[model samples]
Target: MEVETINVQEAILLESTTLSSRQKNEMNVMKTKYGKTMENSDYLEKLEFFVIDVIKTKQMDTLLTLNRTDGNVPRWFVTGFIRMPGFLYAICQLPRRYRYTNCINLFIDSCEILGMICDDVAGSRLSKVDFNTQSDEHWTLFVQFIGVIYREGNSAGFKTKLIRTLRLINYREGEYTSFVQALFKAHSRIVVLRIDFEYQKGIARTVSLSEALDDLDHLVANMRNNAMFDHMLGYIFKVEYGVDRGIHIHSVLFFNGARRNGANHIGHAKQIGDYWQNKITLGRGTYWNVNAKIEQYRQKGICGIGPIHWQEYDLQVNLLNMVIHYVCKEQQMIRSDAEPYRKIIRKQHFPKINEVRRGRPRTIMIASVSDQLEVESI
Candidate 1:
């Protein structure tokens, strides 16, 4: 039962040549139950080094060198194009807009060799994915869905940590797009707003993360309860950092005022700014900017205006969806006890909602060579 090797490991421990106690136990069990194809001691060490080296480096030659007789380990390996390293490179190495369909073709062309490269090399296995999830436009989506489940040997804490780290690294565009699409799909009329932080009379205040958070909290409460948006339908907020201007909050408000095509009082940027500024103050002399915008969904494009609105070219870009994507995008910030820290202020929206419409869920605990069918001849 040689499943096609994907080349990515279940966890970082796979990045090492030595097996954890859990992996050692799994191999021992597999040997007793399924019988060993090769000895575990020296050969398994070689296989471990091979997997770590190949996946991290994404070397084809390294992959070609793998052999069951040499590593003396079970044949489970990285599933599908997960081995090429190049396809996975876009996660961090390649341009955000970069797409290489030829890379998938390359994997298809070499699948047989890749299929022959590993023989019974397992410490982990991939879980089956529902084929319906595959998109005809993005074939790799299905292949990438399968993941190496590091058998019952890895501790729960260890697996949890690995999954957490991967969420920040793996395929995420689908998650972002899906959530954004779902929000605006229900409410097409949107407002994109930004609140900037200004020092009091040009004096920088002590802006700690908690203080900034407090400012955002107060702002959201006033916006929803204020006489201005009292007739509003729904709203959301996001916090982002400025390289020199400091921390600010971004929001998209979906109101019932689309009936006037944005001619109403809430549609005016100046009024929204004035009222928004009065609610949240950063102490002595400090203030927030009322950068607000109104957009309409017409002609399959978003029509809007603001100080920064001229640069927006795509009318199809939903301001609400854009705001949702901006806020929901992956962020990595560790704790800091100092003022002016790079922390995102908005907590996950109350009543967490993840309405994914593409790809797989963030977690997959268990995958096959037979699962590696080309949807179309490459």
Candidate 2:
């Protein structure tokens, strides 16, 4: 069935006289599949030239044009002409920071168009090789890479290469290799913690989430300067449990003196239970439950400190998920060679992942249209 076109393509036609050879081929290919015609060759020619001009400008207009095509444009054509060109252009034209930022924008746009962008796509993008970085842009890349990967027909080997590159980028800083080192070096740590006392709980009906977060933030900041904390853990997080969740925290303690048999001791991680019980109550405010449940707890002493193992606890992982289990959060780094505590480093190569399908009828028409136009004029 014929679908209405978006006006952006019409704007392309109005601003130019004819389609480029490349656009003509694309148009023909699109037309043939639908058993339709780029019936208005004059308009098609103009639109083709317009697309070329936009692509040449490196303005990321391919996205605008592609989106404007409505349902008339098939996936194949969009992938090849629009997405590929825009992706490559952004990669080439933008600075490393801007390129990453724009890539994220494009991925987000695609997600909004496609519905429910998955984490796998973010993972795949993050795994892409860093063009010129000493260390992988792990966080930035992961945000976009996974979305690209989840899009149908992406190559696994390509993703693997990208991920491998990211690993190298992550290792650029030699001094701050482990969490222990990071704790010692404040500059290398990215996150801060906070703790605050509810000056007036039990008097107020409820405490705002913002207030709780502020309290946590205050606690995190105050704990950073603790002599024992600073001595053992440089950048380690100091958590304060509020009366909300039973007043305990899932915390990591840096035990610099902890001993390691084969390798150097990393540090001891622990959870202080019933954190609320230790808090100095404010005048009057109602605090929500923020305490996590504790089950089996064990500690194996390594150096001087212990790596305490608890059954499970919930911690915030990202901006989206408010509550995430400690197990899943920790396990995410299981395959990651970048973790501070990892000892066994194994490299496994997986097979290449993409498989292309035969061209559909619509594909031929678009290709034909794209070919007939003068690519330079467009």
Candidate 3:
């Protein structure tokens, strides 16, 4: 069966069409065979944007020209290429009736071409086989190429390693939850605010990466002195980079809920953002108040913002799983261990809780009599 080559928009529209009875039956059969359908819509959507960007910008040739000798390849390019196989597998798992055939074919073709380039660079016959027929061998070569790119220090290995560590923590279900739980233990309720700090348009290009990082550090240092954050309990910040935004920080601020009682989180976020723009960056920076889009997140059923009580288990889970992951997703992917990037920053010390006696204290005479009686029995 031949698959038609169509634009992403057209393919998406086709995918949305109501399925016929036969198509539905086939989809059911596929689901049963695959054990369970993989719900990777988010990943697939991002992959779609990547595909469109590569095709529209004609970056395929530059991506295919993998030079083993030249050490100038962009880290983003290598990481993005290495992620193609995973994307391909995601597409393949979709039922045939709803799959974007054109996108899958493009990935398959690119993988083959890039695999051949890897073979040439490695001076091996690893890429001589076809991925469609011999997927095991293809995957073996792909894993080998990962080591090749990691040694060159232009791959996603470091970021992947960090994410894996995070995943391990998340799996244990303690680290992030414990942090939040400790905050709640000290305070009756805590307000969570997410703020993104970025440079103004074209301003990032003017300043060097190190300068941008220094500015963030200074801003965070001054946050303690800022009147707005006087009641702040804790904070977490992650650094990331992009072509347009350059270097930026995604920060989550935890405030004493009692102190911020009846306060508008969105307005508070805006005030902090304005301070970052007007004071810290001196009019050269801007910010996004994530709390401003609270309604949208609520609509998406992933609402993890606003004030939360200690008993709000579901909201805490969302904050730990979704909010934290989103903040840490793109952090510190451009650098390596030699000049380590400060990917995440947090408070050095947490608030200590003083132990208080739960019941009335006994008099000194009574306490001494009880101790003497116990010693005599022994």
Candidate 4:
């Protein structure tokens, strides 16, 4: 698939509103109070400040913080990044006091106030969002915040094209991030495959991301002696056309036996790396070298107490949450860089991945069920 190109965030200014001199003075005092209250805070506190920002105007963005606090981003920066149309992606690691449902509802309420109108966040066919989940162990809600609109229909004057463009980039990116994070963490161990330097083509070479993955799929199943080992191989990846590195892939591959079959050590790492090099690279000439790194995260004891001021904001680490974010970090990949190659990359690079590839499901568990020829799970 071609890389998506979105216009970066536009510069925003708060809409002018009529306020009495006394009210303006009160806001000014609160501005100073906010600075002193939240100075020298860490990631946890930044999260709290985000909720406070939500509570301040009962929303965020519209460059509201511009008039209030001097943003010393390098030192006291917010915990997350901002996207197009001034949408704030704050890292919402819920503390002990607040539950995931409560935090997310607040975030949903605040973020829905964004776009041009209150209902602008409403889907074409849907209105509300249901983020309630049974699994709290792997939850990390990245709160999306927007500016508050005092007047209900204040957005009627918004141009049609501008409004459509904002909605597309705003929610689409959020949904993509959420889907990727959920899918990756659902698996037990995620193998991060970094396709470095080897398969990069200079001119007529159409080595796409899918091509490399297809090669890995064949080698992986073949690693299990090509019996019924197709179930052991699985992968999900994103291609990055770096400014200097050209085209490369950042992918997360899964194996059913990786955890119980001693796949954590470097011995297995080298074996997987060697398969990519010898088996997958044999026909690609001397230029084909595969660079692989296996990232295994331990979900235990990953939480820390809340920041000094925001002590209630403690957040537990989700399984593979870090790796999911790392692989899905398309924010750093320049669309302009990838745009030059998107046209040339073709479906031919993918071939018939499904017929030849094997994938692992979230519910699979390998256990002894009588005498079986190979591993089995229910």
TM-score, predicted candidate 1 vs. hidden true structure: 0.37
Q: Please, what are the lDDT tens digits per residue for candidate 1 over residues 24-123?
A: 5544443333433222222322433333333333333333444322332222333222222222211121111212122221222233232312222331
Candidate 2's C-alpha runs over 4 A off are: 1-109, 115-169, 172-213, 224-231, 237-251, 256-378
Against the reference, the lDDT scores of all candidates come to 0.35, 0.28, 0.54, 0.32
- Using lDDT, give the best candidate's number: 3
Tens digit per residue, CA lDDT, model 2, 171-203: 321211222222322221112122112334233
My TM-score estimates for the predictions, one after another, are 0.37, 0.24, 0.52, 0.31
**Candidate 1 Cα errors over 4 Å, as ranges:** 1-205, 259-261, 264-267, 282-322, 330-378
Residue 249 C-alpha lDDT in model 4: 48
RMSD of each: 20.6, 24.4, 16.8, 19.2
> Roughly what TM-score does model 4 have, to 2 decimal places?
0.31
The residue pairs in collision within model 3 are none
User: Predictions ranked by TM-score, top down?
Assistant: 3, 1, 4, 2
